[model samples]
Target: MDAVNLEEQAARQQLFTTLYQKVFPAVAKYVSKCGGSFDEAKDVFQDALISYYEKSHTADVTINSSEGAYIYGTARYLWIKRYKQGSQTKQLDDSSAYSIIAETEAAPSEDKLLHFLETAGKRCMELLRSFYYDNLPMTRVAQLFGFSGVRSATVQKYKCIEKVRDTVKQKALTYEDFLE
Candidate 1:
């Protein structure tokens, strides 16, 4: 049993080493292009590897792409999330920024939008919220919504968006009148 465990550990280590070599450079380049530092790239890449490992080990989740591609994609997503959070924090800390942002907006009230969406039906609201607001991947959204696959979830998302669009058009409201 110890021998088997040692072999498994060795194999996992080799796999990760190979993945880091093959994947890290591209992830680093992407992060750099997105204005992240090398340390941030490395941190996000490590997080991506952990995410990939967890998802791969899950019985219901399947990675459809090459391992490097999956890791790179995950790293990109992590970096974007981190960057957005950082920017939002910075924005919140700058007091004068709020007034400038407020001056630029003329849109339907959140209450009105929520009421319209609520009228669109519960399932549409949940589906839109999961995909857009929660930023869930299509596969996870599919699983959560009991969809057969990603394609179905994607189609359903389009349909829900169209439903909202149609409602907006029926009311003779321009898209900009919604929200920015």
Candidate 2:
């Protein structure tokens, strides 16, 4: 039993060493092209290697690609995940500051804009809400709205936007006339 365990360990070590040599350069190059530092690339690659090790050990999980390709892909995915998380946090911090200022200055205009959207009719409101506020993909929006396909849903979205724009312009002019 000890002999078998030792042999398995040695085999695993050899596999990892070969994978590191073949895959690390490609992963590092990809990370560099994606604006990550060498240290970040190394960190992500290490995590990827660990993930690959875990997955490879599982009986039900079959890797369809070569070990190097799998490792490189995992590294690329990890780097993108890390990059998105950092950028999202940064954006939230920046947007919090801007939201405070915009709320105070734009309250009246925001109300007027809401009124214009309300006048645009309920179906248009639902369509826009599904696509923008809910962040559903065009295909899902099409499914929700019973559109023929993604192309139709996209076309309708733009038309709805144009309708809202025209409505806002016309209402603003009338509102200005009323104030006078």
Candidate 3:
């Protein structure tokens, strides 16, 4: 079951990667013309791809535009939608809106990934919790993890971080929170 899930993830990644390579240059150029950031371009692209996939799955649907055009058009529409939403944001303070947007963007993926690792990656959870939550020093963590020294323990810790961070990043792009 887990292996099946992993394969699904791999295939999805390949599809998205191929689509990105094929479609991104045009989308990126168009988005920049409309004053969008790189991250905004990415968000628009993902939403466009999901929209395309959903549309394709419906019976008897016909797209007048080519796939790349559909994606670009959808992304342009999403960018406009995002701009409208941004304009309506209440002026609490300059920084407040940014903080709120940042939280809205980050919290779901970070929380869910942490929750997942807490279950599936016991060693990772333990190491992260000890280092971060428990405020354990590097030397102590090395002793606890039996890494012989701080340098070795630090290296292992960073490797664990990279693995979890990569998972979090990729899962974030899937709009996993949108499903819930």
- List per-prediction Cα lDDT, in the order shown: 0.89, 0.84, 0.82
Question: For each candidate, what TM-score against the reference?
Answer: 0.51, 0.49, 0.44
Quote the lDDT for 86 in model 3.
Answer: 91
Clashing pairs in 2: none
lDDT of 2: 0.84
Residues 38-135, candidate 1: write the lDDT tens digits: 99999999999999988988999999999999999999989999999897786444667776687577555787788778766899999999988999
TM-score for model 2? 0.49
Q: How many backbone clashes does candidate 1 have?
A: 0
Ranking by TM-score: 1, 2, 3
Estimate the TM-score for candidate 3: 0.44
Candidate 3, position 144, lDDT: 97
